[model samples]
Structure formats: C-alpha cells, structure tokens
Target: MARKSGKMRSFNVAVVGLSGTEKDKGQAGVGKSCLCNRFMAALADDYSIDHISVLSQTDFSGRVVNNDHFLYWGEVTKTSEDGIEFLFQVIEQTEFIDDATFQPFKGSKMEPYAKRCSATKITSAEKLMYICKNQLGIEREYEQKLLPDGKISIDGFLCVFDVSSVPSRTIEKQVEAVLTILNNLIKTKKPIVLVTTKNDDANETYVKEAEKLVGRKEYKGAIMLVETSAHENINVDVAFIVLAQLIDRSRGRARVLPFIEAARVR
Candidate 1:
C-alpha cells in the first residue's frame, strides 16, 4: 500500500485590540494597524511566504471609509526547508460601537464594520492605514464566521495591547475585553498570543506588570506573550510565527517547528 498524504492546514487569525485616542491630536487606535502592516511586509522577505491578497478599509484620504473594518490575507505555501504547506489568513478588527449611540453594533449593523473594499498590495515603503477604536470586534453572525460556538472556525487570536498605554483606564478596559475573550475560548482550548505592542517605547514597570498578568493562575500557562515594536520592525513576525506554531501544536501537528527555527536564524 502507498503512503497517504495529509491535507494542508489553514488557519484564520484575528488581530484584536482597542484603538487609542489622543485628545490633543484626535488620533485613534494604539498600534494594531501598524503591527499588521509590518507583519505583512516582512512575510515575504523574512518568512518566505507568498502573498495571496491584501485588502484594506481606508480610502485614498487614508481614512476608514464608511467606518468599515480592514482585512489582510496571506499564505505560506512552503516552509523554510520545503516542509508541509500551510495557509494563513489574518484579519484586522476593532470593537464595533456606534459613535453617536455608544452601543455595540450587532446583527445586520455588523455587516458594514468589515465591508470588503478595493484590495491593495502593500509595499515595504507604503504604510498601512490605521482605524482607531476602543477595541476590535471578533464575533459576527453573518460575516465570514471567524468564530462561532463549537467546530471552531477561527483558529487563533492575537490580542494586542499597547505597553506604552498601560496604567491608563482605557488600556485597562482593553485588557478586560481580552480576558473576556480568553474565558470564552478556555473550553475550546484555542491558541492565543498576548502581544504587547510599542515595546520600543514601553515602560519597564508596565512591561513587567503585563508579564505578571499573563502568568496568573487563571490562564493556566495557555497564553503566549510576545513583546513587539511594529514601528522598529521588532518581534512582529515572531509573534505571528509563534501563534502559527501554537495552532499547529493544538492540532497535534508539530511540522511548523522547523520553520520556526529557520525564522529565528534569519
């Protein structure tokens, strides 16, 4: 009898976080968009993956038109040493709340939050657009079904928080939102990566506290923490790669380990 080959593993990763506002400058979000852009830019050069499709919600003016969400797609057809093939799709999301009513967007209303727009291919020189929101929306009834009860559509989540914004009430609220997601997924045992962004400007005390928070007994050592700096091109790729490995491990597939080691060497 001939040996049988397994199917390729595909994973959908949601980048969730709250947007920060600078009352003085009127800016939104902490650094979720930047981090996504950085990872996509380095995917080809650093990880040796091929770009499938890249899309965004922002218009020419660099503003998120129709208050929509953004989505970016990519894939790893071959590992560093031509190992098993893997496909990865990453989406950018924020807490969907109506600006005027200050209420969560639900049902048909959620459709516009991540409405697909013209696809854009990002280059190393081009900067990815950013949308500021208190938090990224992860659940949608009608959307691509990123996550739903049982049978787990979404494979993993990258919960990003700005280390520089720690101690602030807004960031604290963001952490609470993340905890809620973790609690919901506890039963599913889904892999999650707690990414601390803006590490280049992170406060040592805040970073230490963040580490301790993830180490709490409630988490049971399930979450992987990675400190990243999207601005300086820091551990952005490492965070995603780790999440991929975790997703593989959760499914009893350890084939991604070789690529991980290859990524570290380069």
Candidate 2:
C-alpha cells in the first residue's frame, strides 16, 4: 500500500554479498535477479546476457513514494554528488563487456561481476554498487552517474544467503564486512537483513541448520531473517518490505555530530 501524499523521500536500497553464496552456489539460477525484480516490484522470468558487468536500474513505487528506484551491485556502495559522477564516467570508460569465469551459481547475477573482472576489462578497486547522486538532486539531472564507492556512506544492507547452507562462514564474513563499514568506516549504525533464499529446499534438517546459523549472533535493531523464493513468490515482498522499513528507520535516526562539536570548540 502506498502512502497517499504529495510529499515523499527518495532513498537508495542496494543488494550485496560475495559470489558463490546464493542457494548452495553453482546450483541456483540467478537468485539475485529474481530477488532484485521482486524487491523493485518488477517481474522477469528469463536470464539476460547484457545484465553482466553493468549495473541495472528498476523503478519501485514504495508505500511512501514513487520514483523510488534501486541501484544494484553484485556488491554495493554509497556516494555523494561528486562521487557519483565519477562512477558513471568510470563505467563509460571501462564497460564490462568481456568473457570471464564466474565460480558462483551460474546466471545473469554472476555475469556482470564476472565481466567486470575479465582480463581485458578494467575493474574498480573497491566493490560498490553506486546509487546516482542526482537522485538526491534538486529536481533532477537528465543523465545520472555512479559514485566512486569506497568512502561514501550507506544506509542499509540486504544480504541474501541460502537456508540450506549452514556453517556458512561466507555469510558471516559478508555480515561482518558490512557491519564493519557501517560501524567503523561510515560510522553509522545501518540496518542489516539476512535473507534466506530457497525456502522450498528447507526440510527438517535444513531448518535446524538455519535456526542454528541465526542463533549464533547479535544484530542491530533486530535479528531479521526472511525466507523467500522468487520461484514460489514466497516472502519476496515481505523481505523487501522489511528492507524498506529498515531504510526508513535509518533515515529517521540521528547521530551526534562530533565534527560539529569540534568546530564549535574552535
């Protein structure tokens, strides 16, 4: 349900994680695309060759707003106006259009990243999915560019992992990395949601594994675990809805401005 109002806030949401982590890796057929489509409120059933390397944009009319589009990176980033332009220019200069080996689950999701690392393709040193700066512009720009990534601040994270795969150190690493950035680099306590994909594959054994995996840690806000299957359309909307709320909550949050405090002393 969309909020009925003339006013709305534009926020950027991104999907991120390391490769070979989706639904048993090398087994699932592009869960990222399916999840992205669902999260962005779109539907697609086929794989695309062009999706490899270059980022994809989709418009999502969120409950509070329209034109609430999301930018996806097989990895992710956050940037300012200046940083975003650099991202777009880099993409233009080094289009990821080449052959490469991707060891993860085979499909469109892995292709863009694979293409990015191709021998001939110039790759970005940092892993970031850029949300265009003009998105936060006054009115807007006809053309939008990606941000440089590394130093920009992110609002939230949606990490997708398979329920059937347990003892997933990879998933742990992914969570730690995002939390590390939010806590240390970005210095904001961003929200994180762990999405358990391929719910249909869950059995008694798998469910126990999933529970144990979730039990192992403490998270900010809440331990958000959403099970989804784009194939079955199970919890797909719920997962993203939770993500939206997290982003909203993040925006409503306020942090102490130490820099301002220091400047005040001067």
TM-score of each: 0.57, 0.45
Model 2, 1-266: lDDT tens digits are 22226423333344543343232233333245556544443235332213333222221111111121123332222232122210111111112211232222232334343222221212232323333322322213322223344222344555555544444334455344334322331233455566666665544554444445446554333546676665565665555555555656532222212222423433
Candidate 1 lDDT by residue in tens digits, 1-266 = 11226555566676765532332112345566677767665443332222111223222112222233443333333232224444555656544333444443332234322221111221111222232221123212212322112111457777776677544345456556555545554545668787887777776666775677679799988887887877666667667767777877532233222222433644
- Return the lDDT, model 1, position 64: 25
Per-residue error for 194 in candidate 1, Å, reads 0.6
lDDT score for residue 70 of model 2: 23
Q: lDDT for every model?
A: 0.50, 0.38
Task: Name the top TM-score candidate.
Answer: 1
Residue 137 C-alpha lDDT in model 2: 27
